[model samples]
Target: MRDLYERAITAGGLHVTEGSKLWEAYREYEMAILTINDGNDEEKAKQVQRVRALFHRQLSVPLADIESTLAAYKSWEAEEGNTRDPDSQVDDVPPNVLSAYKKASEMYNARKQYEDELSVVAESEANKLQVFLKYIKFEKSFGDPARVQVLYERAVSELPVSSDLWMGYTSYLDRTLKVPAILKSVYHRATRNCTWVSDLWVHYLLSLERIRASEDELRHVFELAIQCSFPSMNEYLNIYLTRVDSLRRRMPTGLDFELIRQTFVDAAEFLSPQLGIEELLLLHAYWAKLECNIGKDIAAARGVWENALKKSGSVLEVWQHYISMEIERGHTHEARSLYKRCYSKKFAGSGSEAVCHAWIRFEREHGTLDDYDLAIKRSPLV
Candidate 1:
């Protein structure tokens, strides 16, 4: 039976590591075939149940079968979920030899051991900076601020410029202590050699706002962030707006908003493709948010949303807000069309399933009287 299973694995054209579930199912089917060949009905029945269970568990079932045994399981419906074609061809081996699974398992074990050994040797402060960072992350996740000080101090001393650690540490300060001086120091350290980091610059700007830094300080931070090339121009666009908004709030007549807004608009266009999908959406979203609220250019605000959607299709949050923006402008038909377009593209990946659900709820709760039907039609079950 095991020998037949080996032959069936190769015959199915499935690589062991690449399609482990399919390979396992092929092996089980081979066992079922052998039991039937030996005239053991009871054992064959058990094997059938096992094969059925395998089919139930997998989202991407293999198209072929064990030599000629493919027709026995037609009850299963295959969904094209999370499956990618193998990049390389399958390896062939003699039926008597089980080298594929053995070789792959051995290689995995060796790699795991190497990682474990390196982890053990990396127990020093410099090496375990990730651990301290992780602790800060845990605290952030739970919204707890107790160990933030300890984490921040140790992280700076051990891994001063590690952005993940520094960012995490500074975020704790922002959320818990709201200490302007600490935020300033963190920004300086975090961007010492790597200035293009948008989060670091933004946090620094925020800390400045809290501390009431002089216009000179604000402009300095702005220049430093812009010069660092750490963030795409699109990201810089939003950050620039944030600075403008803060300045306006603190001293409305002190600074020029139109000049800064123009600078950011040019920057966003220049930095469009260089940014990631999330950053790009945020850039335009913030632009639209700022402009629409301030009564600057309604057409430009709608245009910003349109450009963002074109770049990041089916980003539901953007779509929902874009829909809301259109509906607010009495463009109900446009909003309905946008909502449907977003709905059709929402099932992007399993990782974003939660985001998809949130978007559905957002649309349902905030959708206008005329748009609610289409919104509900597009929304999936939570």
Candidate 2:
């Protein structure tokens, strides 16, 4: 029976730690044994030593009601007819041990109010979530990492479908713990519960990449993310962007550009109905920039921009972004040509004036004096 109690205390982990009744029961059992051998002075001495040993052990652990246990131990010493203080009677006791007990008692007292509030039955899941969040915050601020993790586990178990709770837990694990296996487990569980949350899937994919998981593993998770029925086109876009970015980061020089191009194609096909002109243009811009910068394939980049123009040629922002990209890549002639094409087009937007000013600025910086003069003359016509 004593062996069973030891197992419960040691192997039960955090759940049996905070405010467990096991300590009290164990102490009572020791006292009962002492009572059974009442008149044997030698046996009584041994029992007294055993009881004191139990108190000393309990004091070292940071239990929730440590102060009460300490008081009980002192009272027991007094009842055993020890006149001196309990601390002085224990010759082998370390000074720091008592100081640590006092610190643990203070920590428990500070945590009691939050624990009390959390124990009450909440009216709704949202209220419960708020309470749990507050408790988690308090634990993070004042308690050890183990306590914080336990609080997160408790929160997620009760609010499994809460994306916010899952996100917070996974994020804390990612940022604080960085234990790959634990992170993978929590992410898998979180995604299973909140599959519709695109951000969670995105973060999961990034985490897998961060830990340098195999290419097959990363692709498998990305496929799972794509299969989720996300609420918006942007969510799908984010997943695609994250996957491509991860691929780029993993193999910056030897990346298979064809695979990336196929990803862009797949994104376009999957998101066509929901993709607005601006989103379409932004997607093409990202693809073109990757081609120009990473692949060093100017032709492929130009092809992407031309495809974007076919889709959103009338949007002034598209022209500006395309021209800006060319200028940034030192393709001055291409930028000038783009500016000319944009000026010739009769797009419906109030940004035409802004485009003309940008063109004038571009020519002043990148073009010759005669070219700058020509741009100034052509600005009003544009």
Candidate 3:
């Protein structure tokens, strides 16, 4: 009964409490419903009689109190010739009822004020600071960097520490923004002080590279990023490898591949056992990329799949990527052999197994006969 009563109040967004006007009003309405439906059935009549008894037991004032209050209000109105008068005696509504009314009223007013402030902010684009903030929000939502430079130039003088503002402005400088002079400024101010926000440095580096950052600048960015705070070693590693794509032209004669190799060693050591599916797979892809780009070392590329297999032997995508890369390089034998290793491992179901079979077909279609024969030899059916 208590639970039912509580549920009723909760459903109406009211509280069951002493001196609650909402509860009192609801109780009156419920009692009136019983009064109207009292003769429906013998069972229902008894239930209504019980509800009437319970209502009076729970309520301090009787239904007559409401009637008396209403009659007094009518008499007072008749005498004063007005519905409301300061001198008229009226029953006080509960504080909870007034509080609920005030809260609803305030929420509506606050929403209006927020909308008005938003409109004023939008209209005050003549103000450079507001315009800069607008550009940051725009870039954040749409990623269109057209006005980044203009907004940055306008806002940077006043809002120097605003990272989003600076990011927008930096987006405008073209290749000039990537140079050591500019990068040094961003690193000194933003990355160094706020070591926890590693993405800021990563974004800044990418921004400069978008403007045509030199190989030296890319390397410098990586160095500084690693030196600052990398919240997760895998996160920093992925950032380093993603830039390797843009740094491809610089990798051979321009980039110090030896330095990259050392960094890879450091990252692998830090991340290998501690990695999850996404991070582990990304690490493998980075390894394949490094080998493909720098050393053209097939063994290095093969090692990525082998290491991934040791960790997550069931990940069909990892095997697929390895097979694809090998077939692309015309290493049919290696692709077949890896496929053999994958086939030996039992996956959970036929649906899971289908992906591996599809990749084998893809590899066979792309590679030589020596591959299929090797796969046949490794199979149990042979």
State every prediction's TM-score relative to the real structure.
0.40, 0.73, 0.50
lDDT of 1 by residue, 66-138 (tens): 2122222232212212113222112222222224334434534433443343357465765567555554554
> By the lDDT metric, which is better: model 1 or model 3?
1
Root-mean-square deviation (CA) per prediction: 27.4, 6.2, 24.4
lDDT accuracy of residue 85 in candidate 1 = 27
Candidate 3: tens digits of C-alpha lDDT, residues 1-382: 4466555443332111122454455555555665577556986556555544433333322121333433443453354344454343332423443344345445334334333444466545345456556544553454423223333443554455566555544444433445556555655565654555666777766766665766677767777776765667666766666555555655655666666566566666766777777777777777677777687776877786777777777777677778778777877667666666677666666634564555457557865676556555555544
Candidates in order have lDDT scores of 0.57, 0.80, 0.56
lDDT of candidate model 1 versus the reference: 0.57
Off by over 4 Å in 3: 1-161, 175-183, 207-220, 230-234, 252-256, 348-352, 359-382
Residue 15's lDDT in candidate 3: 17
Candidate 1 vs candidate 2, lDDT winner: 2
Count: clashes, candidate 2: 0
**Which sequence of candidate numbers ranks them by TM-score, best first?**
2, 3, 1
Give, for candidate 2, the lowest lDDT window spanning 10 residues.
Answer: 10-19
Model 3's alpha-carbon lDDT is 0.56
lDDT of 2: 0.80
Candidate 2's C-alpha runs over 4 A off are: 1-12, 16-59, 64-103, 253-255, 336-342, 350-382
